[model samples]
Target chain A: MEVIITKDLEKIYNPDTVPVHAVNGISTSFEAGEFTAIVGPSGCGKTTFLNLIGGLEAPTQGDISILGDSISTKKKSEMTDFRLHNIGFVFQAYNLIPVMSAYENVAFIMELLNRPQAEIKDRVMELLDAMGVGDKAHQRPHQLSGGQQQRVAVARALASKPKFILADEPTANLDSHATETLLDLMLKMNEKEGTTIIFSTHDIRVMNKARRLVKMDDGKIVENGKPDTA
Target chain B: MIAKLAWRNVWRNKVRSLVVIIATTLGISGALFIAALISGMMDKWVQNQIETELSDIQIHQEDFVIEEDQKFFFEKEDLERQLTAFANEIKEKAYRIKAEGLAMSAHNTYQVILLGVDPDQEPKVTNISNYIREGAYFKEPGRIKQILISQKLADELKVRMNSKVVINLSDIEGEIVGEAFKVVGIFKTSSGIFDESHVFVKNDEFAKVLKMKPGQYHELAIRTGEEVEVEAFQTELQQGLDADLMAESWIQMSPALKMTEGYMDTFNWILLSVVLTALIFGIINTMLMVVLERTREIGMLRSLGLNDRKVGLMFILETIYLSITGAIVGNILSFFLINYFGNKGIHFESWEEGFEAYGLQAVIYPILELNFYVLVTLLVFFTGLLASYFPVRKAIRLDISTAIRN
Candidate 1:
């Protein structure tokens, strides 16, 4: 079943003065448990499209539905609550709160959701262990390597058990080795837990690992296709 | 966890946080110390006025207070009967024959209030004998037909121990009379005006010169050991006395002293407000910097679903922590300093003339009422919250996407 649908989605920057169309007339849908990559060049609007779908920014004109609930019409505060409960995000910078330890960063979202302490701790430990950063849980983000911090970030994203995770250039700051390890861990989470993951990136390695690719250029999708295993 | 986060945030920039904390500490302690100093000075002024001058209560003929004519004197038999009625409450009492006169020496002449007192009874009621800087009080064996003059008066008249001065005044019969008396004692008191304008003489000698009937005096000064009961005792005395006489407490006798005591709290609050205003700005600047520096982090938290209220609460908690910590330290240090100085006193010997002009001693014992400390603590707490308000509003108004981008 399609968990997210976008219809005629559009975003324009500096709308009145110098209208820059970032995302224009895009209609798309993603199914549950699908690992999809939205790939493009640097200014092709991949990040803006991701932001529009994640409800981080409102569309200039269009509608986005997550789990069949239209989110574009919601108030800013209502949208925040909806996003908290439904969509998990991973940023390129792995923005873990510097003051909190790795475990606290992951558990913080669960705490926001008011999850029981026992369940939050158990799930947090399980996610950290699965991401191969369980031993680093007590350390702050600065103490962990880049790859380890990214793993902790992914663990934080999954802590709330949202319907899907939206990652924007999740490997943009990582080295080749760290990028490979982070991608492997994200893929494992996808396959093992039947979790849906949609990532926007210009990186070929991310596109190569995806089960499906949607290519965009100049704010419009040019191609959507399943990658051939052969 | 939120509180924990806020607490940790306070110490994140050790230097910045310490600056605010120190400013707050200094502001609180400084205001409190100044308040204590004012209170101490006021206390000394009131004490001196009572001990060396007013005593607790005084009685005057109804007309005498309005008109200082010597003829307004009350019969001593009636005064003695009223004193006997309140004998249980009276600690010490004295009758005085008072006259407005001019005292002249070889070098200078000054207007003075001449007081004629029974030397032995006067010492029981006031500290005049103790304040004598040279010579001796009226009762000394060789000091017959003598006067006790203030050092200020002696200085102005250029007279010394055993110098003779002439007191010119009207007698009870409305005739102007001049009497020459040897200056047997020179007294110095904290009140410059009192020292310059008053001289004491033997009441018997004064009566003999004025040709006054026996058992008649112009004023009665009473001292009561139970200070809190002074006003009540005054009221009782007024009711029991003859209709022509009036009894007045020290507060009634000196309106300026009453006003000063009443305005002390208002003065203290104004002082605290001025200090707290400066402190509030310092705190706001510090907290605003903290918010600006953590813009990205705050945006991340908001993106993670922490509501505006929680973000505001976090900032407020941080401010309160800083304020409370500073207040605690400040109060502790102030208490220590106040106690030390309250005992040893802060002496302004160099400013003796200036202090004496206001009837205050040079040595001030710093004092703070217990309630004043509690009020200061409460004020600091509320000040913290007030100072945080603007910064918290700014933090909550941030656009998450823009903040995260920054």
Candidate 2:
């Protein structure tokens, strides 16, 4: 089943001084369990496309329907609630809340959803174990290695059991070793839990991990196909 | 959840958090401590002038004080049976008489607090009998010539008991009259300011010396069973008395104490305003700066489904925690400070020499209490809440697109 779809999705950049087209018209769809990548360099509107699909911003002239519900019609706060209920996110900076331990960072969203303490504890532990960092759960971000921190971030993203996850260059802050560990852990979570994953990255390593890749430059998609120098 | 997130965030930026907390604590402590001091001082002043000396009720002629009109006074005819029934006095019991008059002797003359009594019924409604320190009140008609004056007054006059002195009285006709009397006793009280100025005499002797008919008095100082009944009693007396009659309670009679209460109120408001202004600026500078530095992170939270209200609440709770913690810590610190000063007392060397005519001592050492803590805590909470409002609004109103792109 198609879990994410966009129709003529668009976003304008520098709409003030000189209007720049960041994401021109595009329509696309992703199946429920596919690991997809939107690959591009800086300023190519790949992030904008991810944002519109995730319900973070409204598209100028298009629609993004996640799980068949149009995101454009949701109120700002309702959109946030929808995002929280159905979407998990990983960012380029590996944004682990600095002062929280990995366990607390993982359990944060459940807490916001006002889960029982016991349930949050159990879920945090389960996600950490699945990510192979069960022992590092109590350590804060600064105390961990870059790869360890990114693994914790992935564990946190999966904490709420969202239907899909968006990664905006999740490997951008990592070394070669950390990047491999993070990508492997995410793919493992996807395969085991059927959590669809979409990421935007320029790295060949990350692109190779995706089942499919879409290429874009200067606000337009230039190519779309399997990563078949595969 | 927001609290936990915000709390952790504050600690992440520990220096900035500390700056906000310190400024807030200083504001809370300064405003609170000053309020405690003002509140304490007003209480002390009221007790000293009200409950301690003035016995809550006084009776005087309606137009007598203003007209300086001696004729509108309480006289034998004015002492109706019902009035005397209310007097319900026992000489030397729990009540006494307070007569205002000019006392004159050949040596000198001054205002006096002449009290009249059956030295026997004096204590029934007043405290005068307990305040005396010298020769017993004269009993025999032969020694009716006897009088008690303050030692301070004695020193100025160079006279003592058995020393003959000329007494002068002004009558209802504004005519001056003179008589001779011998001092037979002395009076004193712990509150020295009153001691230095007053002389005591029997009611009949006072009336005779003043050339007035018997049974007249300037005012009656009566002690009732309870203090709360004071207002009711005042009303009852006003309704009961003949025309030109008025009754006053200690609170109404002491203008100075009322002024002190008013001053304390104004002082607390001014202090709180200054403190609140400083705290608002501090929180704004720190929180908004956090937003600027984390433009990307805010975008991150937004993308993660953190909504406007949640984002706003996170920042607001951060400020409230900072403010509340500061209030607690500051209150604890100022608790010790106020108690220390409460004991040592702030001295009023400046007021002492200058305020003598007002009969007030210069030193003002006041006590602190649990009520003061509650009052100050409420004050800090409101101020802190007000200070965080605009910052929270800005965060909640943030446009995710603009914030994320920047």
Best by the lDDT measure = 1
Best by TM-score: 1
Give the alpha carbon lDDT tens digit for every residue of A1-230 in model 1: 99999999999999989999999899999999999999989999988898888887889998999999998998878877887898888988899998899999999989988899999999999999999999998999999988899999999998988889999899999998888888889999998877799998888887898998999999998899885631
lDDT of 2 by residue, B1-406 (tens): 7788888777777887787777777777777778877776666656555433565676677676566555566753664544654654312122223445656656777676655555665555544456456666654767547677766677667677667655555665667766566777765443456655666667677666566676666666555664347677767766777777777766567766677688878887788778877776777777778777777667767767787877877877777777777878888877887888778877777766444344444565545578767776776677667767777777666777566657
Badly placed stretches (over 4 Å) of model 1 are A191-194, B75-92, B118-125, B140-143, B212-215, B224-242, B260-267
Interface RMSD of each: 1.2, 1.6
TM-score of chain A of 2: 0.96
TM-score of 1: 0.92
Give the Å error, residue A51, model 1: 2.4
Return the lDDT, model 2, position A137: 87
Error of 1 at A219 (Å): 2.2
Q: TM-scores of all models?
A: 0.92, 0.86
Which predicted model would earn the best DockQ?
2
